[model samples]
Target: MPRSRGTNGTDMNTELGIVVAGVSTIYGRAVVRWAAAEAHARHAELRLVTAQPAAAVPDRYLPNDVATAHRAAAVRLLADLAGEMATGWPGVIVTTDLATGPPAAVLRAAAEEADLLVVGADDASPFTEAISGSVPGDLLTTSPCPLAVVPRREWTASTALPASAPVVVALDESTISHAALAYGYAAAARTGRPLTVVRCVTAGSFDQAAATAQARLLIAFGELYPDVAVSTEVEPGDPRHVLVAASRRAALLVLGSRGRGRLASSLFGSVSRDLIRRSGCPVVIARTQPAPVALCS
Candidate 1:
């Protein structure tokens, strides 16, 4: 993707990027639309993917007719969706893929060359329910790129975000939170939206010193994106609760896949998974592998 400068000198990815979206149920169509707008905003390509699970039996043991039927159905579905997205989102190049594998495996593979991978919220669609009950959780740890899970809701054909809606990012003591912060800053700058950086401490207590230290991490990004009106908050509550509340007024919520404490060694942190489920807006799990940036201890 080509890079360009934002309105106030914040660098941004401008063109030739790829955004992959999983398509299945009716609600999944909404996911594609949301992704299409994002692709349009970046002047990128939209790749729609639909996966058909491999037969439980070995290929030789399975009936050839059944395999052919599955492939045929997947192809038709993708074709129809591609057509719909083309009409709904003009100017953005749209492509389709039919893969044979588990949903997570298929999406992870598709994300290899994508800048963003989008899926519907769990239980929002049949495909989402089939992905171990949580598509975001399944892909959070393994997606090679950023994963965006959009909730099933009515949205317009345009950006779908109110012009004044702010981009919100939740931070923690984990290194991965830095990736989320950077993603949030870039998103805000790219769209000319305000940013709210939040740090949620444990309930019943507030760590002013810790909060101040975490707030310092934003200094460099703020300088880089001076045009992005930014605000900071250190709230006392459950991280999920605080973020979910913040999400109600946000256009997007950004978080990291892994965080600190007991959830440190887990594949995906509990707070991230919970927010992905309950957030009012789309939740983007920032890339596990990030580009070089200013780091704070």
Candidate 2:
């Protein structure tokens, strides 16, 4: 990915960071539109990427022209999407990259320079491909930055979220959870939305000390983002259930990625998979150093 340049030809990076979106499928188109709106809101550069499957070596059944045509189509798609974003979002620095490779490879390469990678997933569908291998699932494990998995929904005038929708972040006694909290607070502050920090415990047990500790962690972020209205919710139920319910009215649901080992840290555990599959809004997996988390397990 090329770096953005200032008027004096100096290289500069956007504070919100570079946003990469895959734009090859119907779901991907929605993802790009959502990402464009987000990049515009945050004054970030948006890179629209699409990939053409690399040609197989020593193929006798397929002709070269077919591959050429496929590449042509991919080019057209990227150009059209770039044009749409330019028309819709005038000031956003939009760029397009059409790479020759698998869908996952192209997007992951683009994510190397991205602060957040936005992709589309069907909420009603189970992530069977997550285990079997798919783009969003692959990128979820490989993306160096936070991954925003937006559910396919009937968007209102290409608006990703309503004007006043709250940003919800699930928290626990973990450093990664603090990162998630910070991510949520920054998002809320950027969009002028309220913030909700949720902690879930078992049905019959509640630890006031832990709750207090979690609440205390919010003070730093609150001071940093004094304008955002912050609230806390301690719910008695499964973490997935509580967070999904909270997502019903939220603009975005932020969760920390936690586990041990390289593979475990990258993999989305059951709670995150369930939230991504069933949540009422877009679910963002905030990437940070791995840590054990009761809320995210």
Candidate 3:
């Protein structure tokens, strides 16, 4: 049995909300499995959200039949996923909701009270890469909680329970990055993995201010994960480039979905989106979503 408990030993009443978008894609099953497993592990509630065009029928400008068809499709997709999940994990509470808006905004609102938000990595539209306009990319930018980007393949137990793996987290001395750090530490503690914090600075001469910032971030990690082994690195290069390079040897790469400066772009910010597309390991984007009351243990 899974029990939900906060780090501070409180019960969490809210569910671990998963925003499932692009149900028409091949990655749908994988996203469902991953979300179900995570919810089971955390003993959190799971909700499936879908967004469709909301023009009313009959008296409206658009045909209601079109909306009905869309709703039916969403329902079928959820049913298929529910059937698949039930085989492996029964009694898992799953709910479905349909909203009318862009996929990102609809899921974000549905996940308003959720502990974690999950989205598929596929961009259903053609202009995905040029604009980073995919739903997952958009959610990373504006989600109210932590976001998990699931690839189009199920995560095997072997992958989740690797021996002596490293949890790599990128830190930049910002509040968002600190949240990433906190998530990394918690993950490292729960998984019994060593924690490594990497700070990437632009390729240039190292200055005292940069070095001090790096040291402070490392110290914070040390304080957070005192029982676990923690390592720090300060490298000079494009943040994404360095982080992805480091991710090759890591089991998981944790990053902040957004940063403090206006310099960060809209599309998953530059570093996070790049790593998500390129990293060989799983990537967890720590954003400002609702915190779960209890995490299943």
lDDT of 3: 0.59
Every candidate's lDDT: 0.72, 0.68, 0.59
Which portions of model 1 show Cα errors greater than 4 Å?
1-15, 57-69, 124-126, 130-137, 173-176, 203-213, 258-268, 289-297
Give me candidate 1's TM-score against the actual structure.
0.81
Candidate 2: global Cα-lDDT? 0.68
Predicted structure with the largest lDDT when compared to the true one: 1
- lDDT, residue 139, model 1: 76
lDDT of 2 by residue, 151-218 (tens): 77744322556776799988643233655776788888877888888766665445566556556657
What TM-score, to 2 decimals, does candidate 3 have?
A: 0.72
User: Candidate 3's residue-wise lDDT over 240-288, tens digit each?
Assistant: 6787787777767787644323212232265566666677666777763
**What does the lDDT read for residue 11 in candidate 3?**
50
Clashing pairs for predicted structure model 3, backbone only: 5-295, 12-293, 12-294, 42-296, 144-288, 144-289, 145-288, 145-289
